[model samples]
Target: MRNRRPVGIWLTTVLLSSGTLLLSALLAGFLAVVSFRHGWVRTSPLYGIIAFLLVSAIIGTLLSAFFSKKVLNPLIALIKATQQVAEGNFDVRLEPRSKGEVGELIRNFNRMAEELSHTEMLRSDFVNNISHEIRTPVAAIENCATLLISGQLSGAEQREYAEMIADGARRLSTLSRNVLSLSRLENQGIITERRRFRLDEQIRQAVVLLEPKWAEKRLELDIELSEVTYEGNPELMIQVWINLLENAIKFSNAGGPLIVRLSEAGGEALTTIEDRGVGMPEEVVGRIFEKFYQGNPSRAAEGNGLGLALVKRIVELSGGRVGVESRPGEGSRFSVSLPMENC
Candidate 1:
């Protein structure tokens, strides 16, 4: 674990190891010749020639075995590891063998396997969560339909059942839309459409767009924005604000004040949304941006948990960063920093 300088050290090691093997072979051959001359090898001239051939054959066989163990064994291990991985056995890994590039390669392979294992675990958990979320709405709609078909409900009951069905359908539609958007952001490698736009005005529009939701909760707004133009994908950038603002409004306590701040800092446009809601613990804040990661299961019904993930993807695609500041019982602040266009 010391300073691993990849400066011809591995090559030097291979050369030294090969030199030792060559010296060993030469010593054995010299001993065979000396023995033959000293009658230590008691045999006729023709038999002596045969004895030398046997020694050479033994040496050749030993050399083959040595090379097979030193070089071919690691390669075989790698092939086996690859086969296991292809069959979804991410838990399989190989340890470092030599102090050379092969060693480094094995280390990287182990790390890759570890990451694949974790990703597989997360994917399974996410699929299960999605199934549960979708099943709830689907079951509701099915049950409502069945009840309506019975034709034993009053006019009010019929309307209520129909409304419940509509609500369930809407929830499913929202989930589908969010999942598709997040998928596109993550899986597609298309370049983002970029242009110069007034950053402060965009922030204002996001705030105004959610005016109804915030007003319904009797929340107060504290807006402080400055004029700054940023270069990025306008359409995607707008979703960032929408998600952040929606999150702020969603978690905020009734009648609490939400603070929005925009400023210029070190050649970047900084936007921060602070919500006086029930803040989360450190562990929850750390993983909130992960796909389908909801800090509070109690509030899971309100969202399908892809908004923050999409926000992160869009921000990174535009060469920016998103971060969070929060503590339990206090408020949470989500900050986005994007490079501003040279004016």
Candidate 2:
């Protein structure tokens, strides 16, 4: 989905530089010709010219080498690197040599290589993880179906197996839905259906929709929505709140407090959701927003690790920002800031 931009040519500068050296050599030769009549030339006038030309030629050779080191060496490295990259080796990296646009290009190319390598790693991990996740439910469903089809199964056994099959099917459905949602959000270009709507109200609705989870966990909700309205896709904003709130609820310890606050600050609508939950470590916090990145290993099965990634993409698409603050064994706080344009 991306292409390398064409770099500006340094050929003109190189030509000018080499031309300057040639001009200097010509000037030295002219001086040598003038000196031949001043009795300073011990040899023939033709010898003076030849000596000057030889010295000039040696310097020109050195200059050529300098220019080659400055320009051609890196290019050679780049060609080899490009070959590796083209052959499915994203690990190819170029060592930055000098300053200016060429240097910048080298740095950029190295960064691109690093990013590609990391992306390849993530893709491999995603494939493996997704396969395992799908297989677990599929194997369970197959086993449950086989048990139900057996003629020796009792009525209660048939019902249990059927319930298991339903659970497996639901799991597969959820996996598919999450994958689709993430794919859609990531590939979407711009926010559509922009309208001014009550952001706080939308959040409240999301809360009510997820009330069952909070109710089951005996968690308390303290909501302080301050008449905040925003301009963006309402459905997408709702999904953000749903993901944040559901995360808060899911990770929270039983009977803990969950606080959701919405207020206007610095020409932006700030929504802060804090939960008394099993928070994350610093390393985990840094990568929590990555796709299929689950920090809390114990609760890995509770999610497919796409919710926060989707939330981040949606908020960013709305020209807003999402921030997270957390510490292990301490509560976590998620702050989403939407620019209140025209507010």
What are the per-model C-alpha RMSD values against the true structure?
A: 7.5, 5.7
lDDT per residue, candidate 1, 1-343, as tens digits? 2333433544645665566556655666676677878988876545655566567657766775676468756766776787788888999988786768888888999999999999999889878978987998999999999999999999999999999999999989988888888878878665366688888999899999998999999999999999988877788889999999999999999999999999998888889999989988999998999888899999887888889999999888777899999988888999999876453
- TM-score, candidate number 2: 0.72
> What's the lDDT of the predicted structure labeled candidate 2?
0.85
Error of 2 at 77 (Å): 5.5
Query: Candidate 2 on 180-272: residue-level lDDT in tens?
Result: 878887788889888889998999999999989999999988999999777888878898999999999999999999999999989999999
Residue-level error in angstroms, candidate 1, position 318:
2.1
Worst 10 residues of 1 by lDDT: 1-10
The positional error of residue 92 in candidate 2, measured at the CA in angstroms, is 3.4
TM-score of every prediction relative to native = 0.80, 0.72
